[model samples]
Target: MAETMIDVPGYKAGTWVLDPSHSEVTFSVRHMMISKVRGSFGVKSATIVAPENPLEARVEATVDASSIDTNDEGRDTHLRSADFFDVETYPTIEFRSTATRVEAGDLFVDGDLTMHGVTKPVSFELELGGFGVDPWGNYKAGATATTVVNREDFGLTWNAALETGGVLVGKDITITLDLQGSLEQS
Candidate 1:
C-alpha cells in the first residue's frame, strides 16, 4: 500500500515538543479476571523529530512513574512499590521509536519501551489527528497511539492467585498516549 494515505494536512517539518498540559498517558488492565483497572501517569516529556515526511519522524518520550493515579490512594501507593513500578529505583518509563511504517492503511511505530528496569521492543499503532495552528500562532499537531504489553516482560511479575481460578492482576496491559505538540522548525 502507498504511504500517501498516511499524510497529514498542515503538517510541518521540524522538531515537535509535547505540550505537557495537553498530553496524557493512560492504561488499563484486567483485574481479578473480571473488571479492569484504569490509571494515568504524568508525561515528563515527549519530542519528535519530524521531517518533511511525517512517517520519517523519530519519537522519544518519558513518563513519570511516581505520577500514577488510579483514584485510590492505597492502590496508587502499591503500584509505586516494589511489587510494581518501584518508583524509587526506576522513576521513569521511556519509549524511543526505532522505525515507522504504514501497514494496511494504518501507521505503526516500532519502539523500545523501558520500564521497571527492563527494556523490550514494542509497536504502537498510531493515528494522526491532523495538524493545525493554535490561536496563539503556533503550529501544532495531534495524534493517539496505543499498544498492549505483558507486565511480566518488564519484570512487573507480581500477582496473587485468586481462589476463584484466576489471578489478581491480568498479565496483559493496554497503554494509550494522547499527544498534542507544537512544532519548532529545524
Candidate 2:
C-alpha cells in the first residue's frame, strides 16, 4: 500500500526547536488496576528536521528522566529510583525517528524509543495543530502525538501484586506529546 504525503505550508524545510515552555511530554499508567496515575517529563531537548520532502522528515527528542513530576514527592522519588526509571543510571529518555509518513492528514512516525536503558520500536500518530507567528514574532508550529507502550519492555518492571487481585501498576503506559516548536529557518 502507498502512504499519503502532505505539504504543510509554513512548515517549511528546516530545523525546528521544540519550545520547552510551550511543549509537554506526559504519560499515564493504570494504578492498582483501578485508577490511573499521570506524570510529565521535562524535555531536555527536541528538534524536528523537515526536509524538502516532508515524508523524509526526522524527529529527535530527549526527556530528563530525573525531572518526572507526578505531584507527589514520595512517588516521584520511587519513580526515579531503580524500581522505575533509575534516573541516576539512565539520565535521559530519547527518541529518534526511523520512518515518517502521512495518512488521513496525520503524520505517522516510527521511531526507536530508549528508556531505562532499553531500546524498542514505537509508533506515534501526530496531528498538526498548524503554524503561525507567536507573540514574540517567532514562527511556530504545533503538533500532538500519542502512543501506548509496555513499561516492562523498557525494563521498568518493578511492581507489587495486590492481595485481592491484579497488581499495583499496569503494564501499559500511554505517552502523549504536546509539542510546540519555533522554526529555525524557512
Candidate 3:
C-alpha cells in the first residue's frame, strides 16, 4: 500500500519497466471540424521510478514517431514528412516528469513533452489502475493518463483550409495513454 497523500493500494516502490506490448499511446483530433481522426504510436520504451510516496515518482518515456498509424497510408506518410513529425529529423517523442501531485483528489503529473523537436510543459491527469501479481509472479501496475495539446504549439501546423469552413485538421489534440509496467526486483 502506498503511504502517499493519494489513495493507491498495493503501490510498490521500485524501478518498473513498461510492458510495451500491453501499453498504448493514442490520440484523437477533430477532422474537417466535424469528425475525429484517431491514431496510435507504438511505445518505444518507458520507465517509472516509484518511491514509497507515489507523488515522488519519476516517469520517462519515448514514443516512436514513425510508428504512427491513422488507418490512412497517405496521411501517415504525410505526417512523417516535413509538414508534421518528420521522423527522419525527429525520430522520437519523449516525456520526462518534472512534478507529480494530488489535485482535487486526483493525481496529476506535470512533465515536459518533446515532439517535432519542440519541448513544452504538459500535464497528465492520472488514474491508477491498481497493482497486482501476474500468474508468472511478476508484480505489475497500470494507469491511464490524458492531456490535450495544441498542435500548433508543437509546430505541427500543417493544414489546408476547407472550401466550406474550417481547416482540414483541428488544432487541439487529445492524447491518452494506457500504460502497464512490471516491477523489477533487485
Each candidate's lDDT (Cα)? 0.93, 0.92, 0.94
Local accuracy of candidate 3 as per-residue lDDT tens digits, 1-186: 422555477988899999998899999999999999999999999999988887899999999999999999999999999999999999999999998988667789999999999999999999889889999999999999999999899999999999998999999999999999999989
Candidate number of the best TM-score: 3
Candidate 1 ranges beyond 4 A from true positions: 1-6
Which model scores highest in lDDT?
3
lDDT of 1: 0.93
**Distance (Å) between predicted and true CA of 172, model 1?**
0.6
- Assess every candidate by TM-score: 0.95, 0.95, 0.96
lDDT of 2 at 44: 96
| Lowest-sum lDDT 10-residue window in model 3 | 1-10
- Which stretches in model 2 have alpha-carbon errors above 4 Å? none
Ranking of models by TM-score: 3, 1, 2
